[model samples]
Target: MKNILIFGAGSIGNHMTYASIKLGHKVYITDKNFAALERMKKKIYPKRYGKWNKNINQISNSNLNKLNIFFDLIIIGTPPKTHIELLNKCKKMFKYDKILIEKPLCSYLENYNKLENEKNLFCGYNHSVSQSFQKFLYLIEKEKKQKKIFISIKWQESFKGILGAHFWLKDEYDTYLGDISKGGGAIHEHSHGLHLAIYILKKLKIKNFDFNSNIFFKDMENKPTYDVASVLRFSNSKINLVLETDLLEDNPQKKIIFFNSKTKIIWHNSFTKNLDCIDYQNKKFKKKYNFKKNRSSEFEKEIYHILNIKNQNQYNNSPLNIKYSIEVMKKISRTLKNAKHF
Candidate 1:
């Protein structure tokens, strides 16, 4: 089993710990907050966490304690602001090869370039590793006739659902999810859609593009920015992409649509899971891909693939590495700067 060290006890960190343990990895989780760590330990110790209970350890933060242990893989799952600092700390203690950072790599686009330790660092864009998205890529790569492609993603959910479920710290509310300057809100928070589009464009080797974006906010108290509707547009000779992310829609829809003159492909769930695919051509074709365990399995496969990489050097140059994530963040910064506000 690979030695995996995780440095946060938040929602994403907990999820990563669970996924790593399920894959039979020796996971060492550390958090500055003892309460959060205790909660996670209690939550994962039952039959639900499986036989790997002996393999997981929670390290408490102390003045004299230091993480001087070597790990096969290290995950920087902390907040955006704390990433660089943590990376520097990890660098001093470990000679690790593979490191994975949680999404929105850092708080600002400018901070991303300051990351000196990019050796085998990978960003967490788990959607790209998804089986359903892989199938979508298969079909997309095979097509030769489509001259123009259009991609549009609509991601919507309530404030409580996002804040409470993802960003609510144990006793506090509105940690980062409510802060736009801290890389929160619709534009950066729901940026998986933008990254996914960039991933597709880069994979297809279509480079030239025109882009535009808009940010919006409505009826928010103590928040300096809008959370209503944020729009993104990227177009080229081969593809025209339009993505929308917001926190206002009641039904919560996350879907992507690709269109040309005669063909249209629809993939539902741009964030959670890809469950539906509707292909419309001469006739309408429909296919549904189901995952028994859904999101967990996606994370499992992604973590497993990262674990099995034989050459860390070669793997660092992968498409899903931090380089692409930086590109995505750069575009996002530019988009917000040029966006139209309503």
Candidate 2:
């Protein structure tokens, strides 16, 4: 079993810790503040996963040096802004086989440069690596051979859902979720839409394409100061994409659809709490593909995938590879800069 060190005890950190332990690995979770660690043990973790394992270690950042133990894998599950900072911190002190940074990798362009082509690094764009997505991709490959495709990715969901998940947050301002500059906004927060689009292009080996983007900003006395919605489009001859992510929808719509002259194909996440679905439609027939899995299963599969990585070739194929997420970051940079205010 691997020894995993997770930095940050927030929602994502708790998910990672639960994943690690469920996979029969030893886990150590730390945060900059002790209260965050306490929250994880006392409330966040036990509440989410039913019960916390006492074996999982909790170490504050100030006390991290006391660990002195080398880990097999390190996962940085902190906020988007602190990802790179904590990554650099981990490298200085820990000996590890791999490091996985949570999605949106970091907030700015400069944060990405330090990680360019880093062989041992990965990100947490977990959806693309999901079994449901794998099945969707397989169907896509078969369908694409017969016709060119058009893609639409929608990750529009209510901001209330995000806040509710954290439960402890008074509002978006309570965390980084309120500010775009800190990497919390419609585009960055819902970047799974962005990454899946990029992943499809990469998998199809699309080299060059034109991209245009527009974002709608939230108006709340200019307090939160972030984009509330985004629409991004990209295309070449064989394929086209229209992607949208927003925080304004009470009726959440999370799906990626690939369509052509005859067929309308879709992949849906959390269509219900425990199911992922794919739909296929044409003039004569319609079909549904369903996967039943718990919320933590994807995160667990992600850690399992990482632990089993034995070489560069396999790692490069990972959906969580930093390279794939780098493409996501570039797209996000362009999307946010092309913003419009409501």
Give all candidates' CA lDDT scores. Answer: 0.69, 0.85
lDDT of 1 at 8: 88
lDDT for 157 in candidate 2 is 85
RMSD of each: 3.5, 1.9
lDDT tens per residue, model 1, 1-342: 778898987777777888887788888888889887776666533323443355678888773146666688889888776777887787777767688887877765347875544667777877777666666766666553578777777766657566555533541134766666666667666767777878877776777888887777554566456455678888777787888888777667776777666656666653344343434343455555543345557678778767767785657645557777887778767766675321
Candidate 1 stretches with Cα past 4 Å from truth are: 43-54, 63-65, 115-117, 164-173, 218-226, 270-288, 312-317, 339-342
Per-prediction TM-score: 0.86, 0.95
lDDT, candidate 2, residue 158?
80
How far off is model 2, as Cα RMSD? 1.9
Top candidate on lDDT is: 2
Runs with alpha carbons beyond 4 Å of true place in candidate 2: 282-285, 340-342
Looking at candidate 1, the ten consecutive residues that score lowest on lDDT are: 165-174
Q: Quote the RMSD, in angstroms, for model 1.
A: 3.5
